[model samples]
Target: MKPNDLSTSSFIGWTCKLLAILIIVSLVVDCSSKKDVYYCPMHPHYTSDRPGNCPICNMDLVKKEDTSEHKDHSNASNSLQAAESISNEDHSSHLSETSSEKNSRELILSFEKQQSIGIKTELVSKRNLVKKISAYSSVAYDPELYSALSEYKEAVRSSEFLSPEIIRNLQLRLRQLGLSLDQIRIWTSGARDPSELILGGKSGRAHIYSQIYESDFTTVKVGLPIKFKTDVYPEKEFIGKIKSIDVILDKNNRTLRLRSEVSDPSQLLKPQMFGDTVIQVSLPNVLSVPTSAILDTGKQKIAYVQTAPDKFQAVSVQTGKNIEPWVEVLSGVQENQRVVTESTFLIDSEAKIRFGSDSHAH
Candidate 1:
């Protein structure tokens, strides 16, 4: 053969070999791309290139469908099965926890769903739960009460002339005038004059009367410090300690009368002058959560605690005093745990739908 013919033959063979190698490489690449992918049944987002257990839920990963249409159908079926299994598992766990836990139900929400529902969380922590009681107050002035006291004192002095029934009626009149036995006893005993009790005496002090709700009757004690501000002295704060609390609650308005002797050296407070009173009662070093986080179902109190990202568990808690914006968590929750604050009702509705109505029943 000619030398040019031999070189042409060698080049043609090399070209054919290169084409065959390229075809084989293409086939291998295509086959690798077509290999089955595995994903966690419980956590579909967790996938593996090969068969293995899901790192997240520890469930075996199942083969994922390749086609879009088939994948959607398969995912729906798998989700239903996973939900059923999870419900069964949770039911067993809940039964076992009945002895220790008051009530429990686990719930999972996707990030997108959580964003759509505007869920918010807050950390459970130990803090001073300060309860602030606000009430309407006014400088005290009772002419009728003063007259009644004078009559009672006169009756006491003239007991020899007055009958027993008349003196007892006089004392009953003082009690009806909203004086406790202690106050009537003190004034009649001449410990302090009735005028000093009603009006500012030589001590330059004034009497202030505040009406607090029946709900705060236990919180407002005799010696609790109170602060008041009148429109006339908006910038200034008047201070006092509760001197007395009415033994009887006002039946009509459900309020208890609190009498506090305010330091009025300037005598800025006048009779019937209206102001706002605030009584702050501090509860120290208690485990607390946001008030919004608690769901009081009459019989039981439930709080949702975030155990993982987008996951929450319903916890039955014993609540103490409701310090607005926060509440005392006496049990069933720990400090530093995150609790669902906003959209808690929405999550609870979802939990009911998923875990059945009795999921949180005690």
Candidate 2:
């Protein structure tokens, strides 16, 4: 094509391209003008074109307040007094909604606070809370059985390896030595065999060296069936019949010795197993509460009494054996009174806010 004709074509093409670009730019601006940006009420710094939670405070994004939405009530009433009454009515409705929103906000805050603190509670009842006692006791082996096994160990070593006639001769010699034949047989076949003794000779018994309070022992009956468990074998339970309750106090350990017979012959029960033992006592018509509801601080125990919706009053309690998820309440609390089963801590916190320093005192 000729140079003049080509230059004219190029100018026309460039003009068309610029016109398209202007149209696109105009559309983008027009769309942006119609769109709205939102922000968070709690954290004002958070702003976004799309609605969502505030990145800084996790509060919901709200629409920016627009003053233009207010109605022009200038002509609603002709007289000044009438206009004033209308204005007051509108103001009251606005205030009512504001108060309701505040109440809802407080409820949400309380729920979240209770959840984060892991508060839980139980109900209080006054039916004869069982007069019970729970105390730790050490395990021990029978002293007589333990001593008999020690003597057998020495005699077995010679007999287990000896020939039949040699064994006979040894037995006759033992009899001549003035030891009874029963003793000889016991050495040969009984715990005298080192392998027969399950627990070590000296360390055979799990020693219970701890002591119980003198008054606590009075309620315990001799020959009462005892059921217990230990940490070593958590799934296994051991039951024993009380053989004797020692009247003499152990001065060194300051604990009373309560001898018991193993209910079952299974060797599953071992010494040094530390777990709770339940000594069934006769507590006539005693009331009990779910152990999960009680907050125990060792020196004293406390439970929250539900007075109203989400409202509770702290009550001091005397607790007995804990069966886990349930506890024996010796005194304090009444029947059918709902306690904060899941979020008692929230009530405790509110109580703290109401009475600073003394919140958890009870």
Candidate 3:
């Protein structure tokens, strides 16, 4: 137990401890090097000394690439960073191309929409210039016959020679002779009742005479032709000539009559048949269009001028004398222009609705 001996023992113990630690480290290194013998490139942390699959990821561990000649860690890091930056640039370029394509598509759609709007606007502007007029008229009968009946009755009572009983007996005798009592009474009353005013009373039994427009006499030139179609035989057209035109107007009816003789002279063309009369004023040839082309709305007369397929513009026009399927256009129309004949109502309504909506938007 001397001090020097103690110091020497301490130094020996320290040497043994150092040698034991060195031996243990060498054994551990040898064992680790021989363990699994494998490595993974994707998971650089995996380093097995023996051939085997990576425990962290199910991949066959491959031998680590030899990089001992370029062992600088800083150089490896720089190469990886450069590759990552190039990949990012490529992705950015792809994104830019996609955005440009989308922008181009959007521009094309907008252009198409604008063109559609322009077309609609043009159509509306063209359709607003037409005028339309519509009117309604009814067939009327002569009123003077009724007025004359009243005057005739007053005259009969004023005569004082024939009593009411005598008038009744005369009416009864007329009825027995196949004449109506009303007819006799009307005649005795001095009323110019067209139905009661029979010709050749008791003399010409089969013949019946009727009065017509008296003022039309001037037009009743010899051999002048007249055509008429009675409602009784609507299908049959009767051709006639003016036999006589009375110069005197019927005071009650205020209308003159023309007596016409028909070629057939059939009983079908009887007096009191209601129908339309067409008088040819003997005018020269005139330009006209089909009456179907005109759309009448009382206030104005409108016609559709076809501009394109399913496209039309309403035009205001003045018209005169309508003949079946044809009418005389006085103004505001042109020749050879296509006009809407069918489906006019649909076209007119669509045009108006479109125009109204457009105006509201504006």
Candidate 4:
């Protein structure tokens, strides 16, 4: 219509368009604030309603992914990263599902991973654990046997001056001094008279002398089994029994010299023949674990006990009487419980890195 009317219409239309744009902008801002939540990718523990820097990591916060998918990835990432940290300060405390389970160093290993890493397990059972004492021994003569030989000579000579009764009594003394009945018969048959009588100086059997430490002295007992090995015959094993133990201990090493009687029918073992002796003293039935199951971190010895089918808890255990393949458990483990036998070092490394906390913390 008129020029002023046209200007008024144009101003009204421009105002309406500007108001619509502002309203649309306000709606988009409100929707983004309510629907989209941002979180720190580096520090997954830090989350925000909108984009900002992470308080812990100081990194820019990013848009959080789908809740279910993110939770799954976070759990897996935490388990793997639990063993990969080097700092003394833990960056994963916020990821723990429960504070009580923290510092337990639990690991959830899949069946496939357990098989691939050679992780094995065994039951803690009550069994006889032997304390093996290994030491160098020499084939020596028993001092009493030598005195017996001297007594035999004296008795044979004394018989010339005495009656037949005294000679028979002296011959019987030889039998009490470890001489066999056959040996005494041979002595009497060889000599025509008492002066011609000759007694064997050396005993046919071998006397093995081994030094036992003070720690193992109490466990060592008479009739305990011992096996001997010589350089001359490496494959041949000479089994013996502990015959005697010295009352006095060694001044330098604080050890006891024990004797074992070994039968040498072939006379392959001679006096002063050096040999290595292994004295096996069996202990009473106690809870024991496999040697491969335990991991020692200098101060603390650790073992992973399977708490669940796929979960394991790193437990500290007291060890005693460690043999080649088995070790006695003093405490920290119960009877019939399962313990990890292999891949312990790997589990230990993971535990320390995580500060013995939940491996799958999220």
**Top-lDDT structure, candidate number:** 1
In model 1, which regions exceed 4 Å deviation? 1-104, 109-125, 158-182, 189-191, 196-202, 296-300, 307-311, 330-338, 356-359
CA lDDT, every prediction?
0.85, 0.58, 0.51, 0.74
Give the TM-scores of the predictions, in the order they appear: 0.60, 0.37, 0.33, 0.52
Model 1, position 329: C-alpha lDDT score: 85
> How high is the lDDT of residue 290 in model 1?
87
Q: Which stretches of candidate 3 lie over 4 Å from their true place?
A: 1-224, 227-239, 244-256, 263-284, 308-310, 357-362
> Model 2's lDDT to the true fold?
0.58
lDDT tens digits, residue span 1-362, model 3: 89999999999999999999999999999867634347876797878766778777878889754465346765887889899899889988888997664332211113343344432211111111211111111122323433344444554676587677755654454444333455546455544333322221122111221243434333234345545555566787556554333345669966555444454433443334455444443423445666777778667787767655444566777876554546667886776666656555555555556554221111
Tens digit of lDDT per residue, candidate 2, span 1-362?
Answer: 99999999999999999999999999989876756679999888778888999988888899774444322333343466687889999999899997665433222225456567765655555333333444465455344434444444444575666566755655555444323555446555653443322342232222222235665676677656666567776787666656555556767767675544444344444554455555666654546777666766565677777565555566788876553445667777777777566655555566667656444454
1 against 3, candidate with superior TM-score: 1
lDDT of 1 by residue, 150-213 (tens): 9999999999998999989988887766677887888788876777545644366778889998
Question: Which sections of candidate 2 miss by over 4 Å?
Answer: 1-121, 125-219, 227-240, 262-284, 296-300, 320-323, 359-362
Better candidate number, 1 or 2, judged by TM-score: 1
Rate residue 170 of model 4 by lDDT: 69
